[model samples]
Target: MNLEARKIEFVQEFLKLQSEEAISRLEKILRNEKKMSENRLVEPMTQDELNNRIDQLESDFQNNRFKSSAELLAKYE
Candidate 1:
């Protein structure tokens, strides 16, 4: 079968799971896999590029151009 079909079949079988421990293990695996995939999407930055980005951020903060993390999150909620 194709990838999508296999995924659907897997989900169907997963839903029929009766063991709580099994489910918990699967949940942890899925979460870690997802986190790994997310981290893989970001390209690595060089040390000089990293320092320049940090410097720009500090300058922005000094000029009152930066938002706090809480403020940035609050807008989404």
Candidate 2:
């Protein structure tokens, strides 16, 4: 069957579940699958985008618009 049909059938089967443990396991599986899909949705930066980012970083450095490593570490402590 197609994706929609398979999802509907899966939902029907899920609705008939009686075990709490099984439902919890299915919930966990759904959460993990959703997280994995979200992670995969990140697109890689193009060369032009990367170059722009590098230029911005250089500008920030030249203007002294950044913090030192010790300053950053001190914030957490």
Candidate 3:
């Protein structure tokens, strides 16, 4: 009923899965979950140029001329 109980039920059902298709789906889910979790683990910036771009963004925000997230993202396309 609750989130933790649902997670436990999911784990129990997952452990009981015997079909190859079910296993494959579970493996894909686990791999994607691991990739997402790894992205949450931050790596230090080793590039000075990349750091300066971040600093420029900070300066732009302070100057009230920074574009919105949607506008900034659209430029890449």
Per-residue lDDT over 1-77 for candidate 3, one digit per residue giving the tens place of the 0 to 100 score: 99999999998998898899989988999999999999989787779978998899889999997788899889997
Candidate with top TM-score is 1
lDDT of each: 0.97, 0.99, 0.91
RMSD (Å) per prediction = 5.6, 4.9, 9.4
Pairs with backbone N, CA or C atoms under 3 Å apart (clashes), candidate 3? none
Which lDDT value does model 1 have at 37?
Answer: 98
Alpha-carbon deviation at 26 in model 1, angstroms: 0.3
lDDT score of residue 39 within candidate 2: 90
- Ordered list by TM-score, greatest first: 1, 2, 3
Please give the clash total of every predicted structure, in order. Answer: 0, 0, 0
TM, every model: 0.62, 0.58, 0.49
Q: Which ten residues in a row have the lowest lDDT in candidate 3?
A: 42-51
Best by lDDT: 2
Expressed as tens digits, the lDDT of each residue in 23-70 for candidate 1 is 999999999999999999999999999999999999998999978899
* Model 2 error, position 63 (Å): 17
